[model samples]
Target: MQQVFVFLILACVSSPGTPKSVDVDTDDDVLTGLEKKTLELETQIAGLKTEICALEMKMKEERDSNQNQLKGVSANVSDTMKVVGDHTAALATLRLDIDSLIQSVNSPPPTPAPTDVSVCPGDDWVEHNGHCILFSSESVTWNTAKVRCMYYGAHLMVVDTEELNTFLKIRLRAPDGNSHYVGGIDFGQANWIWDSTNTEIGYTDWRISQPSNGRTEHCLVVCSGSTCQWNDVDCYGNKKYICQKAAVHG
Candidate 1:
């Protein structure tokens, strides 16, 4: 009976001590799961780092491109401003040159030589080139002036050449400020002819808008200023005249 009791006690105590190998296997499984999770996390972190590096490189490239564009725009604006400044300066210089040219144009010309009185017929006559010219003081109509010149054995002055016209303009600088009658007359048909020579005057110095073709403007007269341009006026209107004759040769 004592031996039977001892066997029962041994059977109760010999239950495998709570399975130490199963515990060891469970611990190994947990360590393997933890290692797998750690490996996955490390892979994810490495991918993120690569993505971040790529993003950083793209941002740097874009920034460099924007800076280059800004520099190009700035350079273009600077060049445009320089061109504008140069144009403004050139315009200013051109204006000054125009003003100087206008002043020079308005100034009077130099005086010519004295009249050769030896070739003229009388004290009132002046010799130039080959002609004797007389400036009349009395104002008269075109027909009356021609008649008076004919009585003096002369004709109304004819400006046949540039030299003769220039001579007359220089000599006609009398301070009386009177515009003188010439021999030019357009006989109601727009065809101008010198009455004395019955021909076209070869040289002409008309005013800017002379020969306005007014109803009665048929006679020509030298203007009153230093610029001795010609103008057509009414033949009936009275004006001082110039007479011309061939110079006497000794």
Candidate 2:
């Protein structure tokens, strides 16, 4: 409207001497140029708006992709942590089982029933629970004591019954109580058996925590005193021992 009004004022101000028809044509040409410039500007503005929309869409897609990747990474980390937790729990349970096994191995059952017999063979040997037994007066290493008992046609004492175990405990008390070597041995196999019989024990009387798994303690002993019980000791150490033999008249 402003351009049209300006074109009308230019027509009115033209000198009477100029031709009206020529001025009208010049005004029309000026109006056409202005309209063309306006149209071109509107086209450029539309193009810029399209480019902005495209850029916004591309940015949103990238943002969505980044968010998905973050979620995947978080899930992977959670799975890894769960696996580590499970392994830790399993290791704890396994450790407990190993400890229980070790305790069971350290404590074993007793020996079998003794052979039937009526009378002991010698004056030095005494009859006890159907077996001939002799408690030595001299102290010696476990190996030496074993050899000495073998020389006497006997083996180290095998307390197969509670009665024998009690009797020996009392007998040792009578004269200067001390430890005595027995027939039990481990042999580093984690199994305690009678060295004399080469058999697994079926009857036993162990101390409060007897038969410990010491590396060098392969020999067994009857500990001294009223509260005496079986114990493991080093084979090379000196200690008194008991000898045993099956009696006659079975």
Candidate maximizing lDDT: 1
Give each model's whole-structure lDDT. 0.85, 0.84
Task: Please write out the lDDT profile of model 1 over residues 162-233, one tens digit for every residue.
Answer: 877777777776554457888899888888899987997667888777778788999888855556678888
Model 1 steric clash pairs: none
Task: State the local distance difference test value for candidate 2.
Answer: 0.84
RMSD of 2: 21.8
Measured by TM-score, how close is model 1 to the native structure? Answer: 0.50
Task: Give TM-scores for every candidate, taking all chains together and pairing residue i with residue i.
Answer: 0.50, 0.49
At residue 209, what lDDT does model 2 achieve? 67
Question: What is the per-residue lDDT of model 2 for residues 1-250, given as tens digits with 9 covering 90 to 100?
Answer: 9999999988888756478778999999999999999999999999999999999999999999999999999999999999999999999999999999898889786686776548887788898756888889998998899899999889998877777877877776544346899888889776988888889988887766667778998888885444576777888898889999987765
Candidate of highest TM-score:
1
